[model samples]
Target: MRILICHNRYRQRGGENLIVDSEKAMLSERGVEVIEYVRDNNEIDGYGLVKKAMLYFTTTWSKEAEREIRELCRKYKPDVAHFHNTLPLISPSAYYACKEERVTIVQTLHNYRFLCPGALLLREGGICEECIEGDFRPALRHRCYRASYIQTRAVVRMLKKHRQMGTYEKMIDLYIALTEFVRTKFIEGGIPPEKIVVKPNFLRNPPDPKYGGDYAVYVGRLSPEKGVDVLLNAWKKIKRFQLKVVGDGPQRAQLESMRVENVEFVGAVPQEDVYSFILGARFVLFPSVWYETFGTVMIEAFACGKPVVASNLGSMAEIVKDKETGFLFTAGDPDDLAARVKLLIDDPTLAIELGRNARAEFDAKYTAEKSYERLMGIYASVIREKETV
Candidate 1:
């Protein structure tokens, strides 16, 4: 089968970008013909002020992107097209182009851009779902995007324009939500439940399961939304258990100033090195405050047979079975987080048992083989439905 995957690459690469590459590699290994049409956000940097000013309008509908997709579809004649992220660059206009070329559209809900303009249901250091009520004006009023009213206004305009044009409702054939938590949220935001499917991100090249190590590890962005400060505060109370943080972000300076004991800020290691840290950890810590779309590191930790102590919210709560595969604590609560850490450290037997369960879960649900099967079924179903219609 021929499948065309489209993505808008971010300026600062993250886990999502890595997932895109992994997915493409998996498809190619399965002998499927994969056609890519990727756009980069770096293009925005080269834009003049006048064009930047017009970005708000064009972000809603990009004729240039649409035309490019149309040309690619005509040439490749793929059975289906998949989209990852399409914000200001690719836009939802590409979906229209897919329809024009008789291509089945499959979009992955990587983040919460559809429900909230800031793309993370976060505002003023807390969860804010005002936009989920189907109104984005609050995002503008608070300047949620970049703390600038003008930028927030631009995002609001794009969101309003797309909802009016029925781009999400009419143009896209299927939506791949990364978790049940995310799927339910999308349904709440007015997406048809029938049009959405739950598929967690898979672990690529997972290591052999081996539990019990010297320290606990945290792997992700060190921003406020990630609850880094909460983590540092929690670590201050976590007695003997050493914490190693393996990421760098806007809050690095803030984190360094805290002087938390038994915490090592090993900023931004290579992906392979990050995996090594997971393999050598007693457990992984994911203290994100936002309703995470999915936990890429959680699955990786599971693959390495390491238990996770995650915030009891969103995908983290849903993914980590409390006291089964891992433990969960109250979101943004440092005291609760500290207690959970104590639970894992105090009982090495329990932690190892949890790690073993995590490995088993990864084998059952998150292997690349399983992901490939799920994707193939979704593609086939979409094609069959298209033929029937």
Candidate 2:
């Protein structure tokens, strides 16, 4: 199959970027022909004030992206055009380009951007779904995006425009939601249920499971949404379990300043190193306050025979069966988080059982072989449906 994958790269490498790269590689390794039309956010870094001001319009629809994509579609004549991130660079115009060429368009709903201006369903360090179901006023009122009214307004306008244009409804052939929780949210947010498919992220290449460790580990960005502060507070209450944080973000300075005891902040780490950290831990923690779509790291832990202690919210709650594969704590509750960790710490046998279960779960649901099957199945369905059209 000849596939055209387009993505607007983030300034800093984020999970979506990593997933896109992994997916492309996976397809290539399977002997599929993949063509890329990508743009980078770094292109805006050197732009002057006036040029930057023009970005407001492009975020909604980019004529340049449309032209470029149209040219590529004509040249490549790809069977399917799959898109990942298109935020400020590639824009929604890529959809129009694909539509013009009769190329099937499949988009992964990476976040809540289609339903919320903030893209995270997060505002002021908490969950906020004010813009879901086609109402963006609350987002504008709260200036929920990047804490800037202008930026929020810009995103809100893009959302409102494409929403009205039937871009979500008519242009795209399929929408790939990372989890069932995410798929349900999109359905609730007015996306058609039949068009949305649930496909969780998988480990492209995984390391062997390593068990038996005294320290607990956290693998994710140290940001407010990640609930790093909650983890720290929980750690303060119970210094019995040594904590190692593996990732960095804007909140690093604030978290480092807290002087939380028995914790080592390893800063940002590479993918392989993250697996090693998880392998060496007693259990992994994901204390996210917001409804995480699906955490890639959680699966990584499962693949490494490590039990995860995740927030009892969204995909985490569903993915990590409480006391089965991993434990789930009350979201943002430090005391509850501490208690869950204590449960595992007090009973190493239970932790080992959960770790074994988690590894089994990874093999059954998240291995590269299973992922490729589901991915190809989704693509085949889209292609078959497209042929009928």
Candidate 3:
């Protein structure tokens, strides 16, 4: 089948970007014709004041993107249009183009942008559902986006405009939620339950299960929302085990300044290296403060036959089964995290059992083959429904 993929990349590279790239590659590898239309958030940096102000209304609903997508639909006649991200660029306008062209539209909800202005559903280092519960004024008051009132107001306006226009309700055909927890939130925020499907991200080259494991690892962006500080603090309290951190972001300087003897920062490594690190690690630490739509790192750890010690809230709790495949700790609590990590460290036999179950879980649900099959089913179902209408 011919597919057209669209994404608006973040200023800094992230999981969404990686997922988009991986999906495209997987499709091509499977002999499906794939076309890509991409835009970057970096474009906003070069815009003038007037242009920036005008973006609030049109940013998430661009006529130019609509026109371009319409032309692509006519030229390529793709069977499905799979969109990863379209925030601050590409916009919800592309969905209208697909709707007009009678093309199947499949959108992957990588974050909570449609329901919350901050996208993370986070504020003051915790989960905040003000926008989901009501209007986005609380986001404006708190300066949620980039901690800038103007930027936050702009995002809020964009969300409010699309919502009023019924863009999400009318334009989107299928919503590919990363987890059941995220699907619940989207439904609570007014998205139709029947239209939403759960499809977690899959790794292209996952690690093979090993007999023994080495150090405990943390691999993700080093940001306040990721709870890197909590991971570091937790490691400081526990002296028996070693913790290796991968990836770098805004919190690097702060993480570097603190002297922790047991923790070592390896910085950001390539995708292959990350998988290798996961294979070598005894367990992966995922101490996120926000309500993550899906913890890709946790899945990666599972794919590598390594169990995870993740936050008890959000998708992490759903993904990592406590005492089964892995363990869960209270979000933002260093003491809880340390205790769980110590449990795994102290019990090698239990860790081995968890690792074995983790690999089995990955084989059953989190493989690229499984993802492709599920995606094809969703596309076919959407297409058939649209044809009937």
Candidate 4:
């Protein structure tokens, strides 16, 4: 089978970029032909003033992307076009190109960009779904995108234009939501219930499970949405073991200023080193306040057989089974987070049991082989349905 994988790479690489690369590699390893058409956001830096202004219109509908995608479809005769991201670069115009080519379209809901201008459904350090109600006015009024009304307006225009054009509802044959929570949110935002499928990100090369370690770890960006401040507060309450933060972000300076005791800010580490940190942790902490599309680190922790202490909201709540694979604390509540951490610290054997359960969970759902089977099944179903139509 042949697939056309399209992605608009972010300026600062993240988990979504990694997932796209991994999936492409996964398909290639299975002897499938994978044609990639990737564009990077970094290209915007070279744009002139006139071109920068034109970006607003192009972001809504990129004629260049459409023509290129159409040419690729004609050349490759791909069975399906799987899109990972299309904002500010590729644009939703590529979907129209796929529709015109009569190819099955599969879009992965990497983030909430389709439903919210901020693309996080987050505002002011909390979950905000005002835009999900089919009104972009709230986002514009608050300047949710980059805290600039003009930038927010551009994003709102793109979302509104595509939403009205029936691009999401009609052009795309299937939507790949990273989690059940994400699937439900898209359904609520008016995508057909039958069109969306749940597929979590998988770890292609998971390390062997480790039972116990010296410290607990947190392995994501240190931004406000990640609830890193809440984590520091939570750590302050626990004096038994050390806390190691293994990533860096916008809030690094402020977070370091707090100087919370027993917490080590290891900054951003290499991917392999990050896994090594998880393997050496008794448990992992995920205190994200926003509704994450999918917490890749949660699965990474599970793969290492280290239970997580995550916020009890959104994908974190759904992925980590409280008292089973890991424990869930009240979202944005430092006390609750501290208490959950204390549970594992007070009972090392309980942590071991939970970690073992986490490893089992990863084996059952988050492995690369399992993800391939699910993806292939989805592709086959979509292709058959399109052929019948």
Best of the candidates, TM-score:
4
Error of 1 at 150 (Å): 2.0
| Residue lDDT tens for model 1, 330-367 | 99999999999998898888889999999999999999
In terms of lDDT, model 4 sits at 0.93
Give model 1's TM-score versus the native structure.
0.98
Winner by TM-score between candidate 3 and candidate 1: 1
> Could you tell me the lDDT of residue 376 within candidate 1?
94
Q: Model 2 misses residue 176 by how many Å?
A: 0.5
> Can you write out model 2's per-residue Cα lDDT over 1-389, one digit (the tens) per residue?
99999999988887889999999999999999999999999999889999799889889999999999999999999999999889898899899999999999999988888998878888887788777898899988998888889988888888899989999999999999989999999999999999999998988898888766788999888778999999999989898678999999999999999998899999887776777788889889899998888898899889889899999998889899998998899898999999999988998888888999999999999987898899899999999988887
- Which scores better on lDDT, 1 or 4? 4
Candidate that scores best on lDDT: 4
**Residue 325 error for model 4, in Å?**
0.7
Instruction: Report clash pairs, candidate 3.
Output: none
Candidates by lDDT, descending order: 4, 1, 2, 3
Name the candidate, 3 or 4, with the larger TM-score value: 4
Task: Report backbone clashes per prediction.
Answer: 0, 0, 0, 0
Candidate with more favorable, higher TM-score: 1 or 4? 4
The residue-level lDDT of candidate 3 at 120 comes to 94
Name the runs in model 3 displaced over 4 angstroms.
45-54
Q: Locate the minimum summed-lDDT window of 10 residues in model 4.
A: 232-241
Instruction: Give stretches of model 2 more than 4 Å off.
Output: none
Instruction: Report model 2's TM-score to 2 decimal places.
Output: 0.98
